[model samples]
Each structure stands twice: as structure tokens, then as C-alpha cells.
Target: MKIPFSLPVIDDEVIAEMMDTLTRTGWLTTGPKVRALEKEIQIFIGSSNPVLCVNSWTSGAMLMLRWFGVGPGDEVIIPAYTYSATALCAMNMGASVVMVDVKDDFTMDPEKLATAVTEKTKVIIPVDIGGYPCDYDAIRQVLARPEIRKKFRAEHVRQQQLGRILLLADAAHSLGAFYKGRAIGTVADITVYSLHSVKNITTGEGGAIALNLPSPFDNDKELVFLRALGLNGQNKSAFEKNQPGAWRYDIIDQGLKVNMPDLCASVGLAQMRRYRDRFLPERKRIFQFYLNAFSRYEWAILPPCRNDDATESSYHLFLLRLRGFDETERDRAIQQISSCEVGVNVHYIPMAMLTLFRNRGYQISDYPMTYSLFANEISLPIYNNLTEKQLQIVVDTVVDAYYSIAGTEKTNVV
Candidate 1:
């Protein structure tokens, strides 16, 4: 049988919970299970109130933008090396995207990012791609610039500004990831985590947001209100209306339908139980195995676990790059590896390469480093259950595929 790219590891616990939710027959919305899952995530991240689940990472992304007050004519800075959803979230809110190039490491270079920030920049979404954390200190330093701060404040609010550009993180890749022992959750003003099936944990299809703003209301007050925003902006949620026939509610604001169902939340809660205790360490071991295999190969650049001594990735995706391979050779090697029964995939094509960015007149060639990195990148499977024999097959396939395409004799691992 051929190996798939990724799969959710579901135990009987998840199944049992799903059956329980069904048999109990009251949960069609965010209920006790969802609330419990939210608490679990909050305890894990140690964030203030306002942690909320959305239908997907994109929903969380847009919601964060909305909270930061990004709307028409506002521009949000985003890395070119990320999934389209990262930029699209800003675009969905009618915000123009200031696409910035990434370093060869596939992270936004903080220096380059600062240069892109202008008076119109409403937010900056730095992605922790391939599970490697971006340099938070560098990003924060850039956002702290006085002139930039004044311009953003004067232009956006025209009066009472938030004092700095919001560092909204697309930490969809980093869940357990740490920077200076601080988890990704509280690193930025707001960080959204993807609990998509392929992520470190699966909620079937879901995401969560964690806030790091100034807090006097850390009493889990914001979390209760946040649910109202997703479930029709009603003042009273279903559970709240369950009191002694006083089932009345009010529409406070016009919101969207993107809440996590108990069905999905049940899966997340189960995964959360295993994330720190089981899944992460297993993934770490697999990451170490890949590092050991690829370390001697000078052409192989390992993803950063920490940036200048301040980050630890979730080790979500192992992105391998070929040093001297051209585009055709890289694609051929991927094909060869697939033929060898290892399913390989590309991280992304720059947004500019697609019709949407092209229509906007954005040029991929202009972002030299972004194009260069994309040209050689291939995503290798790094999930928990990927076995030793499977890993050997993966390693051997990559080696043979490279040699088959390059037509070179077996060289040392380097």
C-alpha cells in the first residue's frame, strides 16, 4: 500500500465522545464540550480571555483582522511564502495586501518586513511556516518604530491609536511552538492556530484564536462574548437561554456563522489530551530522525527550531529543499519519490504566480527570494504514526530520486 501525505490519528476515545454527543442529543451548537476544549487550549497557551474557535484558519484570520479594525483601504503586510489563506483573509475584508518577500529559510525577514510597513499598514501577519517560528523580537522591534507608529495611528484611527502596529500572527503552523519559552499563542497581539486535519492536532476542520492584548478582563469574560460573535451575534447563547423558561436573547451585532460544533470540539478535546502528552514528543522524535538523516547533507538546510535562541517549532512539516536543482529537476525528483511510494508535495506557489495576484499586477519575479525558495521546496511527511520502515522508505526514495534525476553516482550523505 502507498503512504498517504497525512492522516488523522483517531483513537476510540474520539469515537466514543462522538457517539456520546449523538446519544445525549442536545448539542447542535457550541456546548459543554466546546467550552471544555476552549478551557484546555487557554490553559495550554496561558492567554487572556477572548480565545474563540472558528470554522477554519481563514475564518480566524479574518476575525482577527476585523478585531484589529482592518477594513477597506487598509493594507495588511503578509509573507509571500505562506498559504493563500494568509493573504486572502486580509483581502476578504477589502484590505489591500502588501506582499513581502521571505528569506531563503522561508520566514519573513524582519528587516525586509519593516521596509514594507507604511502609513497605510493596518496589521502584519507573519506566518510561522513549516512550523518554524518567525523572529518575534525582530518583528516587534520593527513594529515599535516611532515614525511608523505615528503614521499608522494618524492614518487609521485619525485619533486614538493603539500605539503600535498589531502583530497578528498566522501561527496556523505553530501550536505547541515556543519562542523564548513563550508559546505562539501569546507571542503576537493575536495568534490563530489551525486545527485542520493535517496539523499537529485535528478537530476534523477547525481553528482557534488566542489574544495577547492588554488585559484587565482576563476573567474568561471575553470568551463568553466571543461565542456571540460567531453564533448570530445574539446576546444570549443557547446555553444561556436554558434558564427557567426565560429563553430570551438580543442581536448585539451582525456576525457570521463560523462557530466550532461540539462534534468537532470533541475531536479537538481528545487531541488536546494527547498533544503535550503523546503527539508532540512522537513528532519530535520523527523530526530528530529527519534532522539526523539530512544533517550531513550540506545542500539540505534544516528548518529552524529557534530563531537566534528564542523559538521552538511544533515540527509540523518537514520542508526539504534541493540546493542545486532547477525547477524541472525538483518536480522530477518529487515525481520520482512518489513513484518510489513516498507522497511529496510543494509548500506553495507564490500568490503572485496565481491569476489573482497577477490580475493585481503583482510580480513573482520581483520577489526573487520568494520564487527561489519555492522553486526548490518539497514537503515531506512528518506525522506521528510515520513508521521506521516508512521513514527508511522515505529517505531511500529521496536519495534514489535525486540520483535518478541528477544521474550522479551515490555520494556521501553530504
Candidate 2:
């Protein structure tokens, strides 16, 4: 039997919603549907702040960095284990990217982050790789330290009002994840949730920014400003300008056109309506099934899911690590699994290992732990449409490949 790595669950509901958006909704781009989706997300994530939908995660992140006044000579701290987009967003804003190593669990190491802080640091972006939430409390503690706060030199009104570095969560893979019994959106000052095809919740292609800034920031006022920036700096959106006698508007500032269309927003809106009761629970069940199957094997190093009551994953990618295996062996194992018609993949190549960053003077040697995780990691199939038979095939194929590679005796099938 052949099985793909992942598949988006675009059911009849999603189709119907898309049709409704295209046919019934007169305002197609960045209109009522987009606003409704944003409101739904705010309610679902339990964030008391504004939730702004954008065209993509990268665009939302770029807007946030620009709003925070990141520019040349400024530094943005990020974990080296994350996708290149995390670093690229800051780089696009003319800010220097400061890479830090991650812990064994694949989240940013707060201790290493402490050492990397400097007076120029403007943002600390901790990625929730594979749906697992980072230790936000620990990272927050590091930023809140007197010396670290004292080192901060605010260069903009947003920076000066906060009086410290910003904590932006790259929660692309962690929309339904929970930290300390609370949803991910509220944990960070600004959490960016991806609506890409491979994410827990998909809008075909979109993203949302949960603005949970502290008091004196006026989140509502900031939301209006961000909405304008997303729409080519126009004071009035097309829908607003359509009102009778409201055609006159103003261009506030030079901003990026990254507004989310109502067409794309409709897809996610349909999925999120039943996400808590349907989608999320199904994903978590699959995670447990894999955990139960792989736990007996001493060589199968499971990815972090529910470590404690305080933290729970979105069940995005099930990254299984091979114990005592080097990079070559892991690659061979993936090939073996693929040979059996089961698709598999690696989570990512470390940012320092990428050619773009390497040319920019970054080195893999600087991030030892990040390299270690990348070497042995293999992301398995975990999607809502996966069938029981396909799951069994995946497990059997993986076990066979491991035994074949290790040249060990095959244990009896349980």
C-alpha cells in the first residue's frame, strides 16, 4: 500500500464554504468574510486582543518587524533550528539576525538566549517546531532580567512604550497547541499562526497575527494601524470605500499589500468552526497511536507531545529520531521507507547549514544541538485523512527499515 506524507482535509464543508464565499459574498477581497474569520480565530484562540489575517506568515512577520522599527544595526534573536523564513523576515527588515541554538526538545534554549542578548536586540522569535510550544515562561524570564532590560535601547515609539525586547512567537505549526493550560495565541506578545496547506488548520494559503501586547500599547488602535499597512497604507479598505459618499480616503504610509482575501479566509473559517471538537482531537489521537506503537522500540526517539498538563502539542509533525544513528544512516533509513512506497521527510536543515545563511557568515558549528536534531530526525505522516491501514503500513515499514539498517534480528510483530 502506498501512503503520502500528509494530506489536507478539505471536506464537503470546506467546498461549500468556498462556493458560498465566491457566489454569495459580494465583497470578495479583504471584506466581511475576512473580518468574520478573524473574529472567529480570536474567539477560538481565546486571545483578548485583535487577530489580523494576512496573505501569508512571512508577510505578517515582516509587517510586525517593520512596525517594531527594526532596521540596520538592530538585532533579532531566533533559534537556528527553525525554518529560514523566521530569519529571512528579520533580514528583509534590514535587521541583523542573531541565531541561537535550540535545546534537545527542538525548542529555543532560554539559557543560550540569555547569553545572546545585547543592547541592539529588538525581537526574540521562539518557534514552536512540530506543534510543540516553547517554554515561553522561561524565555520571558530571560528577557525580563534587569540587565537584559537595561541593555535595551528603544528606537521607536512601540519599543519605548514596551521598554524591552519584543517576544514574537513563530507559531506556524502550533495553532491548536496549549502552554500552561492556555492557548498559544495568548502566551506571546504577538503570535503568528500559519494557514498554509501543511499546517494544523489550512486556509489554502493565509496567516493570522494575534496581537496581545501589554497595557499602554492600545491594541485596538494598533489593530487599525496594522490593517491599513496590510492594505497598501490606505486609510479605507475597498469595502469601506464602497459605502455611499465614503469614496474619499487617504494614504497613511508606505506599506505592504498583504491583506487576506475573503476567498482564502472562508476555507479556514469552515475548518476552525469544528476544529476543537473534530480536527484537533483527531490529530491528537493519531499522535497517541504513533506514540504507543513506537514506544516499545528503544531506538525510536519520540517527539515531544504532551510532556505535562501545562503543555500540549497541535500534533503537527511526528518527528521520530533514530538513536545512535548518524546523518548518513538516517538518510538511508528514509530511503528504505520510501522504497516501500511510504513517503517521509526531514523537518528541516538548520538555518546555518543552508547555502544562503552560510554565505552570510553563519556556521553550523555554532549551533551544535540544532545540527544534532537535524541529523537523526525524520518526520512521519500525520494528517486528518490518514486511515488505520495506512498507519499500520507506516509503522511496519519503519520498523522493517530500522531492523534492516541496523542488521539486527526482526522482533516478533506484536
Best by lDDT: 2
Q: Write the per-residue lDDT of candidate 1 for residues 1-414, one digit (tens) a residue.
A: 477778887889888777778788567567788778877888887765457777799988887676556888888999988999998999999999998998877889888888898878888899999888888888988888886666675344411345567788898889999988788888887789998998998788999988766543342555566667677777776766876886988887676667888889888888898788889999988888888888877667666665556668899998888878888999999988888677889888889899999999899987899888888888888887889888877877887887788787777566
Report the number of clashing residue pairs per model: 0, 0
For model 2, residues 1-414, the per-residue Cα lDDT tens digits are 889897887899999998998888766788888898899889998877889999999999999998888999999999999999999999999999999999999999999999999989999999999999999999999999999999999999889899889999999999999998989999999999999988888888899999999988999999999999888899899989998999999989888899999988888989989899999999998888899999988888999997666799999999999888899999999999999999999989898888999999999999999999999999999999787788889998999888888888866433
Model 2: residues with Cα > 4 Å off, grouped in runs:
411-414
Error of 1 at 241 (Å): 2.9
Task: Give candidate 1's TM-score.
Answer: 0.94
Give the runs in model 1 whose Cα sits over 4 Å from its true position. 48-50, 154-161, 215-221, 307-310
Please give the CA lDDT of all the candidate structures.
Answer: 0.81, 0.92
